[model samples]
Target: MKGKIIFFSVFFLLTTGAISAQAKNAPRSIISTTALIRKYHDQKELSGMQKGELLELYIERIKVLVKTLPYIALVTKPGVTMADLGIPDDSEHKKSLENQALGTSTFLDTTVDFQRKMMPYSDKANLIAAILFYEGTLKSLHEFNELNEM
Candidate 1:
């Protein structure tokens, strides 16, 4: 009985700590487009905050969009496909998108890691690069919204 109790307690603690860390990393919420526009005066809300915060938000959304892609596929109506989202149904286009996503992910990680190490420094170069990556994420989101009619 004592061993079982200790084992369960350790398991619970580890999982709880992991969950907290995950939540902390996920700073951006899936807020309505209206709220985002109201606050940021734009659809993407990419430049709403200072350099560090903006980078974090962009990274969060990029990861969410990629992760949400599978969910989008599952919920999309039958017979509708990537071609409907203005993407071609071929390897060349698919590979292009994959490359874009990879670049976004890399940019996100590089910015985020740097910002974490040096917070509150809104360097122009970092902001410019972040904005560029953000544009791709915004375009993808617009396509997703168009697909879902949201």
Candidate 2:
């Protein structure tokens, strides 16, 4: 009886440890951008570094998912340059996109007449984080509008 109890106890301990290790090593499921923003929004306060870290994580996931995103067809006639469509040159566009990825661009955060609303965060990191949430909300709204229009 004593030997059987010892064996069962050891077996239980080993199984529990293995289960815990597996849980610790498990990869977290990816949630939607809006859901991520909502998770952060629920927090009462987040330091600039924390916000920046979240933004970096968000950007990394976006980079990973780029290949899976829908393609935008850019059809143009012969001899038509990007400038004809008011699009900046390659270098300028690259810089602009980089700023956008960093969530520091004012152009996209403005109204039709370029009227800008002040963001809550004054620090760059916090501002970038706030912009991440703002952009996510805007993207969701645009998608919703498109579906309704269709």
Candidate 3:
């Protein structure tokens, strides 16, 4: 009986430690397009921030949709396009762009809402970190877009 209890206690401790480690290393919460816009206004490089926020928001949104949408088989099939994510490809890229923008905006709004709710409980540093990350992500995306365009 004593041996069993010791084994169980050790197993519990190891499992809890592993869970704690994973939780700590998990990626930060997703950033939204609106949050990116706010960050852009807060910083001098508006375009860079805008791009980063948009890309990150899109990727995260895609991940969620892929998980929840049953009909989205191509999501994991590889070599998918915006159309796979419900963006229609037609004459002009306008429609696709619009859909992307709307999706990103919605994602950002959700993030902002969550941030506001946690404001009273979370540390200021966490909020700041989140903002910085969003801005940084936008900056990187902007650079990549510029390169592709060039």
Q: What Cα-based lDDT does every candidate model obtain?
A: 0.53, 0.43, 0.47
Candidate closest to the true structure, highest lDDT: 1
Q: Please list the residue runs of candidate 1 whose C-alpha ends up more than 4 Å from where it truly belongs after superposition.
A: 1-81, 120-150
Give the TM-score (vs. native) of candidate 3: 0.33
lDDT of 1 by residue, 77-138 (tens): 22343465565556775566456556756865786676567644656456646655655655
Give me the displacement of residue 110 in model 2, in angstroms. 28
Candidate 2: 10-residue stretch with minimal lDDT? 67-76
Q: What are the clash counts of all predictions, listed in order?
A: 0, 0, 4
Could you tell me the lDDT of residue 40 within candidate 1? 22
Residue 13 lDDT, candidate 2, scale 0-100: 100
Q: What's the alpha carbon RMSD for model 1? A: 11.2
User: Please, what is the TM-score per model?
Assistant: 0.32, 0.25, 0.33
